[model samples]
Structures are given as structure tokens and as C-alpha cells.
Target: MTPMLLVMVAIGGTDILFALDSIPAIFGLTQNVYLVFTATAFSLLGLRQLYFLIDGLLDRLIYLSYGLAAILGFIGVKLVLHALHENNVPFINNGQPVDVVEIGTGVSLAVIIGVLAVTVLASLTSARGKAQNAVAAARRHAAEYLDMAKDPIRRADIFGKLLAEQAKIRALPEKYRAQIREEQELMALLHRAHAEHGSTSAR
Candidate 1:
């Protein structure tokens, strides 16, 4: 096969593996093969986009792996319970169905969607919160250094540190980049002042 064909085959494999759980999970709602097939098709169709969306954010969300595991576990438990409810094994429950309530397909769908929504929201919120906190802390440290900068040498040191922090924040497309710009402005002023009064500025 051509390289493109090989790549397509690999991606198809990945898609099939990923959808394995949902194939059976949807059947829990109804034994209607057509309904199950339609629902799974619709669901996986949207997942192609979702895969990229989550892939970009995987680095930001530290607990994403745990969240996915929880989802799979929940589905596995649901399927097991369903099997027990439809029990036909002669060795268990006298070949009778389980007495416990079986979760309906609608409820299963709702719970799965709810958990996924919450997981994505929580991950993004947490990642943004930590980023904000770091920016705030950098601001506070820069302010302290500015206050303590009585001599030109001390001021230059403060400017260096602030510029370093600025470089870090420049990658984030937010208000923090503006704050870094302000720091760069201050650093330039300090550099000009030090150049003009070189005699006393070094000490």
C-alpha cells in the first residue's frame, strides 16, 4: 500500500479501538441493532473533532488520564450490571435475572455526557487558574524588586528578573503579556538612566 493508505489504515484502527466501548454501551439502551448503529455512528462522527480538541488540551489538564479512567470504569460497571440483570447462567441466581434495578439507556447517556462535560470544564478551569496564579505571583515579586531598587545596579538586577518573567508570559495570549510589556518599558528606562550616570550607577 502507499504511505497515505498506510496512515489511513492506522487511523482507522485507532478509531475502531476507541469506539469499542461505545458500541456495546449503546446497546444497553435498546436491543434494536439499527438504533445502536445509528447512535454510535452519530457519536463517533463528532468524536473526530473532539479528539483534536482534547489532544491540544491534554498537556494542560493534569488529571485528564484519571478522568478518562473514571469514565471507562463507569461504563464497564454499567455493562456488567446489565449482564447480571439479564442473567442466564444456570450456576448463579438459580438461572434467574438479577433483582437490582438496571440503568436505562437514556440515563446512561445522560450520565456519560454529564461526566464528560464536567471533566473538560474542570480541567480547563484548573489550568487557567494555575496560570493566573503564576502571573499574579510574578507581579508581586516584580513589585517588591522595584520597591527595593534604590541604586542603579539594584534597579538593573530587578529589570533583568522582570524581563525574564516577561519572556515566560509572552507565550500566553492574555492580559499578562501587557504586564510584561510594561516591565520591558521600565527596564528600558533603567538602562537609559544607568548609561547617563555611569559613575554612581555601578555601585
Candidate 2:
């Protein structure tokens, strides 16, 4: 398949998985069908805008996966606990409800919010996050510069951003810098962008 087609397929698959995962999580939070439907609708509608808003900062959020995992785990545990509390299976709890403490909605909300807050703070403040952000920014800007080669004004702006990211990468410690898997490729791309920009300006 073509690259565009592949991208479309990947996006469609991701959306499907997201809907499947999120609906159950929402149900875990509350069994209110109306609220779940509205929440899912709004999330799907706003997902594109949300992605664009945070696109540049995504690489900086190194701890985001961990936070999401924690949240999902919490929700799973809560669901299990609620199921046990309402259990009626003859084999389990002797056909009676398990007296396990169920997590409240307020507490669940607070825990989710707290985990998100801490994850963002840690990702933004950590050295590794900074390194990853710088590398990602450099790559993004380099690609932008090349794609906007016809637009001198925008190309120059992108080149400027690329240069700033390059500086950040240089300032990082050797240990962190060494972690860049494609440093040579990135540098070559940057050099090509610079050469192209110079040639365009000279014209």
C-alpha cells in the first residue's frame, strides 16, 4: 500500500482500539449510558484538535505512557472490585457479595488527575525528556524546512527553529547525547536543509 494509505489504515486501527478501550473505562467510571455516549462522542470529535494542539509537545511527554498505564490499571482494579461487590456467582463468595471496599468516583477522578499532573511535571523537568524533546524538535524542523523549500519565508523560520534545537542538543551532556540513535542521519538532514536554504537565498 502507498504511504498515505498505510497512514490512514494505522489511524483507523488506532481509533478503533481507542474506542474499544475507552468505552469500557468510561463504563468503569459510571454505568450511565447517556454520559458514556456523550463523553465518547465529544472525545472522538475533539481528538484531532487535541492532537494538533499538543503535537509539538508530545515528544517531551516521556512519562505519558507510564501515567496512562497507571490510570488504566487503576480503572481495571476498580472494575474488578465493583464486580466482586455486586457478585452473585454461586462459586465465588458462596453466591454472596464480596465485602471488598470499592473505590469512589471522587477518589478515582482525583487519582487520575494527580497522576497526569505528576507525569507532565516529571516529563517536562527531566533531563532525558529535554534531550528527547530537542532531538524531536530538530527532526521536525528539519523536515519542515525541506518541505517548505519553495516558501522562502517559512523555510527560513523553520531553519531558525532547527538551529535552536541543534544548540539544545549540543548543550546536553555526552551521556544523554549518545542516546540519540540516528545522530548522523539527523545531522545529515540538517546539513542538507542548510545547504538548500543557502542556495535558495542566493538565487
Candidate 3:
């Protein structure tokens, strides 16, 4: 199959897996079937909007993966504790319910929200995150400038953004700046964009 078809297939498979994985989390939060159905439906429907909303900010959210992992881990532990509390196995805890603390839904929601808030705050404030965002934005703007080379007006705007990002990168720590310079592909893209912009300006 074509590359685009392959990409579509891969994305479809991933979405299916994501949906399946989320079902447990939904049930863990609430057992109401109607709520679960609506939640799943809306999540699926909002996937496109969600993608657009975070596409530019994804690189900036450096701690997002860690936060998500923490959330999932907390939920997993909560589920296990819940299972232990309702234990009915013949050999496990003598088939009696264990006296374990079950996490309340309200507490779980608060922890999830709090963890997300802190994660976003930390990511946006860290020096490393700032450097990474600058590098990513510069790279993206350079590519966009190249793609819009024929459109002088649009290219001008993108080039301006690219230069701004480059300035940010330069103002970063020497180590971070060195890392960006070491990226040969990115450097090449930036150089080509600059050359094209200069040529266009002279015309």
C-alpha cells in the first residue's frame, strides 16, 4: 500500500488501542454505563480538535509523558487496591475482603487535575523546556518558510517567526545552542530558508 494508506492504518490501530485502554480508566472513574458511553464517544469525536489544539504546544509540554505515566500508575494502583478490598478468591486473603483503603473518586479526580496542572506549569517554566520549544519552533518555521517559498507574503511572515525563534535559540545557554548547531539537518534547513529569503528580497 501507499505511504499515506499505511499511515492511516497505523493511526487507526493506535486509536483503537487507545480507546480500549481508556475503557478501564473510565470504569475506574465511574461505573455508569451511560456516562462511560458518552465519555468514550465524545473523546473519539474530539480527537481531531484535540490534535489541532496541542499540535504546536506538544513540544513545549516536556513533562506531559511523565504526568500521564503518573496518572496511569495512580489509577492502576487504585484499581488493584479496589480489587483487594472486594477480594473473593479462595486462596487470596482467605477469600475475605482485605481491609485496604479505597481511593475515593473525588480524591482521584483532584490528584489527576493537580498532577496535570503541576506538570504543565513545570514544563512551561523550565529552562530546558524553553530551549526545546525554541529549537522545535525554529525548525518548524524554517520548514514552513521553505514550503511557502513561492508565496512571498506568507513566506515573509514565516521567515520573521523563524528569525525570532533563532534569536531565542541564540540567547539560550551555550550548551543548548551548541546542541542546536550540531543538528545538521536543522541547520541546513535554516540556511536554505535564509538564502531563499535573501534572494526573494532582492527581486
Candidate 4:
């Protein structure tokens, strides 16, 4: 969709084609204009809300583009099959309609929902695992430097390196951060204790 249009352009020209097909389909089922208007209105309203819910999931679904293309292709093939079944072209099928199976609304909806659920679940699971690994790796890095040396200057050097690394890391769970900070504070106290001892022994 275009971010903005110089003119209205009939909802970017696509709406016009959809309207042509939908209007006839609704009219074939019902002549009541009011019923048609309400049906279309509610459908659009529901779809708008569904789009919001699915928007964030777009990035997570790595195969979204492929999935949508597959769906559109399936619908195109079905339309082609339906057309051939009722085809009236004299040369093509001798003006006779052939029998063909149609996809039901229930089956279509179920398949769509199943695909979406699988993708979303897989994405969320992958994200969680990555986050856990990141946090674990950060903690390991911090712990490695924490107990490396007992010399005050060396310990402070290690602590400074950890601080620098911490700044580069992404957002983590608060509890993990708190634990790190607590260890850092403990290390600071140890440094101060060593400093005090050095001063007293010099006296």
C-alpha cells in the first residue's frame, strides 16, 4: 500500500476490482441493499481489528511472504478450476459444465488458522531461546571476570571491562540485572576493604 497518494485514486485502484466481484456475489445471494451494506461494514471492521493483532506477528513469521503467495496461488487455482467446471466456451468443452469439488468455508478457515498458529508459536519459541542464551552468555562473561584476580587494581580493571560489556548488551530481565549489580557491589566492597588494609599497613 502507498503511504500517501496525490489523489484518492479510488482506494489505489484495487478496491474497484474487488468491489466489482463482491457486489455481484452479494447481490446474487440477496437483493436487500441494507443487508449487504451491514455485512460488508462488519466484515471490514472485524478484519481491521484482526490486522492489528497480526501486524506485530509479521516480523516473527519468517515465511509470511511465501505463505501469503501460496494462499493466493491456491485461490487462483480454485477459481480456475471452478471456471472450467462451469465453462461455456464452445470450443473448449463443447459448452458443457463439468463437475468439480469446492472448498468449504470451514476447511479453508481451519487451514489458515493452523498455519498461522504454527508460525507464531515457532517464532515465539525461537525468540525465547535466543533471549535465554543471551542472558546466560552475559552472566558467564561477568562471572569469568569477577573472580579472576584478588589484586585491587586488577579486580577494578576486570569490573570496568564488565561495565563496558554490559552497556553493549540488549535489554535483559530485571532479576538477572539485579543479580549482576549485587555482585558488582560486593566486589566494590572487597576493593574498599583491600584499600583500607593497605592504608593501615602503611601506617
All candidates: TM-score: 0.54, 0.85, 0.89, 0.41
lDDT of 1: 0.65
Q: Candidate 3's C-alpha lDDT? A: 0.86
Model 2 / residue 202 / CA error / Å:
4.9
Clashing pairs in 1: none
Cα lDDT computed for each candidate against the true fold: 0.65, 0.85, 0.86, 0.55
Worst 10 residues of 2 by lDDT: 48-57
User: What stretches of model 2 exceed 4 Å from their correct place?
Assistant: 1-13, 46-57, 201-203
Best by TM-score: 3
RMSD of each: 12.6, 3.0, 2.1, 15.0
lDDT for each residue of candidate 2 in 1-203, tens digit (9 for 90 to 100): 68999998887676666666699779767989999998887776666566666776577899999999999999999999999999999999899999999999899899999999999989888998889889888888988889884677878788888889988988998898787745788878888888987888798
Query: Ten-residue segment with the worst summed lDDT in candidate 3?
Result: 44-53
Model 2 steric clash pairs: none
Cα RMSD, model 1: 12.6
Ranking by lDDT: 3, 2, 1, 4
Superior by lDDT: candidate 1 or candidate 4:
1
Runs in model 3 with CA error above 4 Å?
1-8, 52-55
Predicted model with the maximum lDDT: 3
What is the Å distance of residue 157 in model 2 from its true position? 2.3
Tens digits of per-residue lDDT for model 4 on 13-111?
A: 444445444554444344489987876666544544555556544534555665656555555665566677778988877888767776555555566
> What would you estimate as the lDDT of candidate 2?
0.85
